[model samples]
Target: MPRLARPVPAVAAALSALALLVAGCGSNALAKQPPFPRSTIQANAADPSEKPITGSPTTGDPVDPAFAVDKLRLLDPCKLLDDDALKELGKPDDAVPGGFSRCSNFMKDKDGKDLSITVEVGQTVTSEIKKADKKIAGYRSYEQVLEGSACFVSVITQDEPGLAFTVQIGYKDGDGCVPGRKVAESVVALAKGKNASRTAAKGSVITVDPCALPSDAAVLEATDKSPRVYPYGLHNCSWVGDDAEMTLDFRGGFVPKDDKFDSKQTEIDLGGVKAYQVQTTTSFPSCTIKWVQLRGEDNDGEVVEVKSAGPKKAEFDRCAKAQSFAKALLPKLPRA
Candidate 1:
């Protein structure tokens, strides 16, 4: 028999190393292959015709249900608290829907002090909870003080870390966070699926587009030049000119509860409508005025604000100028 050829140890070691290198290269090459584009998959998933009959398809690893706030679209914050809950919490007698994902419930004490609950629905809560000041009910928690009266308790959903909501509760004489947490708990307990239906009545301020409030002539009269309109959101607009600036905002929800301007505000009558005019001397000379299209309700009306650098190159009063624009714009506003 041919002498058994003892393989060279060095050569054998080299071969083994080479095989390992080849295996690693194969894995890297597989990794470099492009993954299926998520956008394409999402598009297909979105179309009703593409759903598989037997199993649900997903884009990636399933999200934790605790962090999911999408169901908020189906909920109305105003409906979360029953009469018993409301009474137990001092009976917030009014509910104001701020938007699709927010609401405020409030009542006033004998002293004209407000007791209120405000709720906001949010997603991406997991990250927020990671930095929470406390933990409650197996959820990340935090608190905030609003205007020195209200306490807000924010809780991250345990099933879905990225989903969360806040309950803002306050009584002028009581600890805000304590009530806030209780309300938050109740809200969570009541967070079952319920259809949310909302509508803005015709000829209402809620239906008006703030950017379209000013006419060309009104813009010229107020700014002394052509107006450049910038819409900040569904209910806010701004106009800019050479030396003038004006903003139209929706302040219905906040104006009713705020007393900050009660001492300085003066009324400006526009036809049958009443508006509050306030002059500010801080920062720059400016005037702000609010008019009611809908009163006694939250998020109810339009606020027109005008600002200038100072009294210069002017033949008119700053507040008067603001008032003039508001008056001119009022008739054009939607009528209820």
Candidate 2:
């Protein structure tokens, strides 16, 4: 099983907003900022060219979340499945569905490769691109995942009122799926969003596990100089010198345009977590840190002990959250 460590990625430094929108092709929402690297114990990257590659899907943790990995199910191939499997995966198999087996499989490319993944959705969600089904808590199955051009489907069923069971099929575009991977991903993502909204309205526990969630990830971070943060989507980010606090400016996403950093005017609110932007001041530790702190229910259901080694309370608080989040999540991580 893979586990989550403390400290979220810097990309998640900001909060994902209900009003903000994520593209169906992928989950483009994260909170932490980038450019900061501290105490990071990571693994090797996924060999994009390996056959039957079995390794951690993610290589490093985002700056917003300094202590965790790419937990988001983004690019995960488990969104498409057939109708029969959807019912079996979400319900009891006391007598098993007569004719069909409960398992789902993926299609391969012409070169003869295992380039897909299949998953059954028993929940709803729209967090990350890979976890779109998770964010909404809708039922889906990823019947196949085709290398770069992955595809999947989400089905909405009502086995347990308010909770929809989804059969998902995930496959890649490179494997020859119509409409390409991006388009397929977009279709499933849209379904995930709709299901998420519905679940929220009904107040249902759409998803019961953490699949690298979006809403539950309140961010804090510093980034790596490489893979710089892209300027688009619902993101509120900045670049801070090792020890300077320059005035932050938010144009797109949620930060109001031209909003000054006044105590009342400037606030970093990400669902269950809120960072009151006090007056900007000189920064300590003259080093850029792309780190991610945690917030919301992502903080719960786990046993944790947060002992801070700090110079200031806020620093301790921020750092502590990041660390604790990772530590708490480690136990639940799946094998990459």
Candidate 3:
């Protein structure tokens, strides 16, 4: 008993070193996991569904929240925001959403900036009711005053393959803020027709009144009587310009089914505008899932498809939006 095992100093030193190495790795293991199948906190926890019932600091905490925008996603979520990243700073509006609770999935540029800044404009003639998911559609924007400057950071969702904001990010000159959105709006206002920087969003599926026309159509109604422009999003549905009737796919994008699906456009003249209506049904089902069906009639799988006019078009993106909108619309439509 008096010996006290002092005979193995070398062994004791080796054991201590091994323990420190293990501890170091254990600390970072949570943050070091890959982002694909999506990392879950329950990986190490014994119970996957054992959610905390009360508000406690012991809730689902991430080893690392800023999981490099390239990896962490709200279409997926990373672990958690670091202690320093949470230091609330900037303007009153900068702290607008507080933690940007409505936002998920932080997507930034190469230099690390949030991009979810697209907002809806004008009043809707119809209710802002969701045609698809009942929840309001949008994301979060982060605003903060950094170094005496007003700055906003938003997390844009990857609704499609690329960025989701109608407004792009602007460069920082050590003063002022982003400029893409401003530039885009200006372009939209200046647009004669196809030249406008007017971008549209794909939203929940909603039925259109057979007697209704697009908002843009109302504008052209004062001018040409050939091609008509179909405005989308309630405010605008159809417009007549030269001798053509334009179908605004603004409410929906071109969703293709297969290569064999028709790639033609429906030409109509409203107020002589010379507009082309690219039907979603005319376009091939871009995705095997979310296939669009006839709005009312039991046309079965005989859904139509449509695509844009020119060569440079977003066929796939348009189809995706159509599919999503159709899926949302089917459940809400008056139903045949």
Candidate 4:
């Protein structure tokens, strides 16, 4: 499972409270919330193309490739949960961008209870899709409850077999799957119509595919041999070789500074941009390099991160490897 690289601040706070419930720390609060309900909806496994909705952008078209991964990278995930789409759910707060391909909307029900809805595009799905027992808005959908307070509803958007549009609902006061399924349907409907907004800024990292950033030779130099590639979501990619691994990640958040990760972090000059290098052996031998690629409003900005890791017994310096790869990769990134 791919974890969220950066969560919106408000959503993070909300999830933190829910995490306490999951940890069995809030029994008194848990008693006030309704029990998770059994789903009564039946599964529809029939081909959606067989019953195409009239005038639907994705139905009955021989080459309906609008939702392809490349196109999805350009569409804004924050726009998927617009007021018109989420009006039926509750009073929605402004949509906040979580990362390149993720956005979150926090809402309040009529009873003033909190609900969080997050939309993440281009998620890499594997065996998780096997649990998909329902189809929503002409797409295969999977619903799962998390810690009995949140629900995840993912719609398989690509037949290429790994991409999905996932909607997550955090509602501790009610059955989250019910709202989760409804939000998934709304997401599918809006996406099929091509109604989601697009990122307007030129040279934004969201337009760049992380998998295409580093050259094969560059990866080989870092990993010691031919490497296998793994793309995570739309903004992360990794190359694993026999003895080492390298990862590239693009995320949006406040600029990183020293003393942030509780490790030995040093500021280094990568070309002209100021970059931070953090080396840690908390788990294994690993080092990470990050630099702000574009400054956004306030303290938030776009960040380019590179990580290098190897076996603990390896004699090579991981920080040196991370810095070397970052220098080579930074020149290839799109500038603001």
Best by TM-score: 4
Candidate 1 residue runs with Cα over 4 Å from true position = 1-194, 254-261, 296-316
Residue-level lDDT for 62 in candidate 1: 23
- The better candidate by TM-score, 1 or 2, is 1
TM-score of every candidate: 0.42, 0.22, 0.19, 0.78
Better of 2 and 3 by TM-score: 2
**Cα lDDT, model 4, residue 256:** 37
Residue 44 displacement in candidate 4 (angstroms): 22
lDDT of each: 0.49, 0.24, 0.23, 0.65
**Candidate 3, 164-219: lDDT as tens digits:** 11221222333323433342333223221233122211322222331132232332
Q: Mark the regions of model 3 whose C-alpha exceeds 4 Å error after superposition.
A: 1-181, 189-194, 197-210, 213-251, 254-336
Candidate 1 local lDDT, 202-284, one digit each (tens): 45454455566668787677778875554432345566666676666643333344533346888767667666777766545
**Tens-digit lDDT string for candidate 4 (202-261):** 446877777778877788888988876766666778787777999888875554343253
Best candidate per lDDT, number?
4
lDDT value for model 3: 0.23
Across 102-220, the per-residue lDDT of candidate 2 in tens digits comes to 12233333444332222322222122223324322223323223245434333322211111222322233343333223323443453344221211112111111222221223212
Query: Where is model 4 more than 4 Å wrong at Cα?
Result: 1-64, 159-161, 256-263
